[model samples]
Target: MSKKNRQIVLASRPQGWVQESNFRLVETDVPALKDGEVLVKNIYLSLDPYMRGRMNATKSYASSVEIGQVMVGGTVGKVEASKNPQFREGDAVLGYFGWQEYGISDGKGLQKLPESKDIPLSTYLGVLGMPGLTAWVGLIEICQPKPGETVVVSAASGAVGSVVGQLAKAHDCCVVGIAGGPQKCNYIVQELGFDQAVDHRAGNLQEDLEKATPNGIDIDFENVGGEVMDTILGRLNTFARIALCGMVSQYNETQPAQFRNFGAMIASRVKMQGFLVGDYQHLWPQAQEELTSLLQAGKLKYRESIAHGVENAPKAFIGMLKGENFGKQLVKLSEE
Candidate 1:
C-alpha cells in the first residue's frame, strides 16, 4: 500500500450553484490500523447529486459536511490490511468512506462485497448498490405499480431512475421517462425498454408528457422535482402513488422552491411520499439479491459516468448537479 493517501475535502460552502473551488485535494499519511480495525483502499467513489446538498450548512437525511472535512460518499474498496477477525486481506467491502484513497474502519457499517468476474466491483456503489436499492424500495415497496398501470419517472436516464424504469417495465407497466435531452430520452426508451420517453429540455414538457401518457399517470417515480414534477402532478389519476426520490432540479438553487401543482396531491388524491434508502437498511440484501438475478438474466441494465481520479471528483460532482452526468457518476480512485 502507498504510504500517502490523497483526499478531497470540502473547502467552502456553495452560495448557489456548486463550484469546483468548494473542494480541496490534500495528501496525508496513511494511519496505522488500531485493534479490530481494517484498512481499505477505496477504488470507486460515487459522485451523487445528494452530495451537493451535503455541502450546505443546513441538515438533511444525513449530517452536513463541515469545511475542512472529507466530503461524504459511498465507496467500494479492497481490504489491504485487517486486524478484525471478520475481514481478511484483499476482501472487497462497501462503506461510507468518503472521498479518499484510504479508509479505516472497525467493521461498523462495512458490508462484504462479492468477488466475482461476472459482476464488476464498481456495481457495489451503483446498480447493485444504493441506487438500485432506492429504485427497488421506491418502485416495488412504495409505489406498488400494478400491471397495466402508467408509470412515469423523472431523470429517467439517471442511475436510480433508470433502475426504477426497468423494474416498472418488468412488472408489465407502461413506463414513460422524462429526461433532459434527445440522446438520454432515446436511451431511456430504446436501450432501457421504457414504453415512452419525453425530453424535458425541449421546452414543451407539458405537451410531451401528455402525448406520451394518454392514460393518467398511476405511478410517478419522481427524481427531478421542479416543473417536470408540476406537470406530472397535474395529470395524476386518483389514488396515484408517487415515490418522491431526489429533487435534482432544485439541488443547486439557493432559494426555497414554490410548488405550483402541490395541490394536485389533494385534488387528484396522489400519494406522494418522500423516502431515504438509509431508512430501510434491513431490506438492502434482499433487494441486491433480486437485482443480481435480474442482471444475470439479461433483464436489467445500468450505466456509469466515471471520473478518472479523486482530484477530478469535484468537477464530476458539479457536472452531475448541472445534469452533465449520464448515469451513476463515480470517481475512479484506484484500479482493480
Candidate 2:
C-alpha cells in the first residue's frame, strides 16, 4: 500500500469559540512527484492566532479557508524526493504547506533553509520567522521606538509580543509587558527582561497598567484587542504610536469588543496603523539578520509549546488562539 498521508482539513467555520469538530483529519495516499515538483515530508507546523481569523468566512488580507480545504499554516519540512533541480533530497525547505504530514511543491514558493546546526529548524518557524519579523517591523518601522520612551506590549509573552518587548528594551526604551496570567507576566519580566509586567487577568488591569506606566505609554504594540487595548489607549502619552497587530482577544468573539477609551487616541494625537507582515516582506531578510545577531549575543530569548503529530494540530491551534501557548505554538509532524 502507498504511504498514508495524514491531513487536517477545515470542517466548518467557527461561530464564537473554535471547537475541535471544526477541523476534520483525513488520510490519503502520498502522490508521486512530477517533474519540476518536490515532495516534502513536513516536520514542523506553526500554529498562530492569525489562523483563527482565516477560519471565518469574511474578507481579509488573505482568502478564507474553505470547507474541506487543508488548514493554512507555515511548515518546515525536509525534501524526501525531488524532481526539481532547485531542491535536492535531504534539503530542508520552508513554505506555506498548511497542516499535512506531506506536501508537494513546484519550488515556486518553497524556500530552502540554510544548513545551520546553531539555529534549530523550529526557530525558523518562530523568532527567526514571521513572528520575529512582525515584532521587528512593528517596533522599528511603525512605532519607531526611541530611547527613554515607555513601550507597552500586550500579549507580551507570546511569540510576537515577547520579541516586541525585547526589541523595545534594546532600543533603550523602558518596556512594560501585559500578559494573561502571573506565570506569563513573570516570564516576560524575569526571563525576557521587560522593565515591568502587568497581569491583565488580575481583575485590575486599568490600575495595574497605570502603575506599570508611570511615565505614560509612548508606544503600544497591541496584539490582544478589547479591554487590554482599551486600557492601553487610556494610558497613551501625547503623540504615541500604536502598531495594531493581531486582536487575538476579539478573534473568536461573536460580538465586537467595546472600546470605551478610543477617544483617548484623538486627544493624545496617537498614530495607530494596522499592518500585515506580508507588506514588509522585503525587510524580512534584514530583520532576520539583526534578530539572529541578538540571539547570538544572548540579548534575545525564545520559547515554544510544541504538540506532537499532525493529528493534534487542531487542539494546539485552538490553545494558541486562547492564549494558552507560552510562546510560539507549533506541531511536530516528523523528526528532522
Candidate 3:
C-alpha cells in the first residue's frame, strides 16, 4: 500500500480570531516523482504571525490564501526521491512546502542546505532563516543603531525581536525588549541579555516603558504595534528611528489599531519605515552569514515551541499570534 500524506488546508477565512474549525486536515497518497521532479518529505513547518494576514479575504502585501488551498508556509525537508540531476535523494533542502507531510518540487525554487551537525536543520527555519533576516534588515538596514544609542524592541522575546535586541546589544546599544508576560520579559533580560524588559500585559505599559527608557528611545524595533507602539512612540527622542517590522497585536482584530501617539512622530521627528523580508531578498545571504557567525561565537541565543504533528499547526499558529510562544514556533512533521 502507498503511504498516506497528511495535509492541512484552509477551510474558511478567519472572522476575528482564528479557530481550529478554520482549518481542515485532509490526507492524500504521497505523490510519485515525475521527470525533473523531487519528492520532499517535510520535516519542519514554520508558523509565523504574518500568516494571519494572509488568512484574510482582503489582500495586503501578499495575496490571500483561497479557501481549500494548502496553507502557505516555509519548510525544511529531505529529498525522499529525486529524478532531477540538480538534486539527489537524502539531500536536505528548503522550500515553501506549506502545511503538508510531503511535497513535490521541480527543483526550480529549492535551496540545498549545507550539511552541518553544528547547526540543527530546524535553526534554518528560525534564527538563521526568515525571522533572523527580518531582524537584521529591520535593525541594521532600517534602524541603523549607533553605539550608546538606546534601542527598544517590542515582541523582544520572539524570534525576530529576540535577534533584534541581541544585535542591538552587539552594537553597544542599551537594548530594551517588550514582551507579554513576566516569564518572557525575564527570559529576554536574564537569558537573552537584553539590558531591560517590559511586560506589555502588566497593565502599566506607559509607566514601564517610560522607566525602561529614561534617556528616551533612540531606536524602536516595533513589532507589536497597538499600545506597545504608542508607548514607544511617546518616548521617542529627537530624530529617533523606528523599524516597523510587524503589528502582531492587531493581526486578528476586526477593528483597526487606534494610534494614540501619531503626533509623537511629528514632535520627535521620528523616521518610521515598514519593511518586508521579500523586498530585501538580496540581503538574505549577508544576514545568514552574519547570524551564523553570531551563533558560532555564542553571542546569539534562540528557543522554539514545536508542535508535534502537522495537524497541530493551526493551533500552534494561533498560540504564536497570541504571544504564547517562547521564541520561534514550528511544527515538526517528521524526524530528520
lDDT for each candidate structure = 0.90, 0.92, 0.91
Runs of candidate 3 exceeding 4 Å displacement: none
Ranking of all predicted structures according to TM-score, beginning with the best and ending with the worst: 2, 3, 1
Which of candidates 1 and 3 reaches a greater lDDT?
A: 3
Compose the digit string of candidate 2's lDDT tens values, residues 1-336. Answer: 778899999999989999999999999999877899999999999999899888999998899999999999999999999999989999989989999999998999899898887888988898999899999999999999889999999989999999998889889999999998999988999999999999988999999988999999999999998889998999999999999998988988879789889998899999999999999989888899999999888888989999999999999988888888999899999999
Score every model by TM-score: 0.97, 0.99, 0.98
Which is better, 1 or 3, measured by TM-score? 3
For candidate 1, what is the TM-score?
Answer: 0.97
The positional error of residue 80 in candidate 1, measured at the CA in angstroms, is 1.0
Worst 10 residues of 1 by lDDT: 252-261
Please give the TM-score that candidate 3 achieves against the real structure: 0.98
Error of 3 at 81 (Å): 0.3
Q: Rank the candidates by lDDT, best first.
A: 2, 3, 1
User: lDDT tens digits, residues 1-336, model 1?
Assistant: 748999999999999888889899999999888999999999999987778788899868888999999999999999999999999999999989999999999999999988899899988888898899999999998998899999999988888999999989889999999988999999988889999999988999999989999998999998888788889988899899999998888887767766787898998888888999889888887888889998888888888999998999989888888788998889999987
Candidate 1, pairs of clashing residues: none
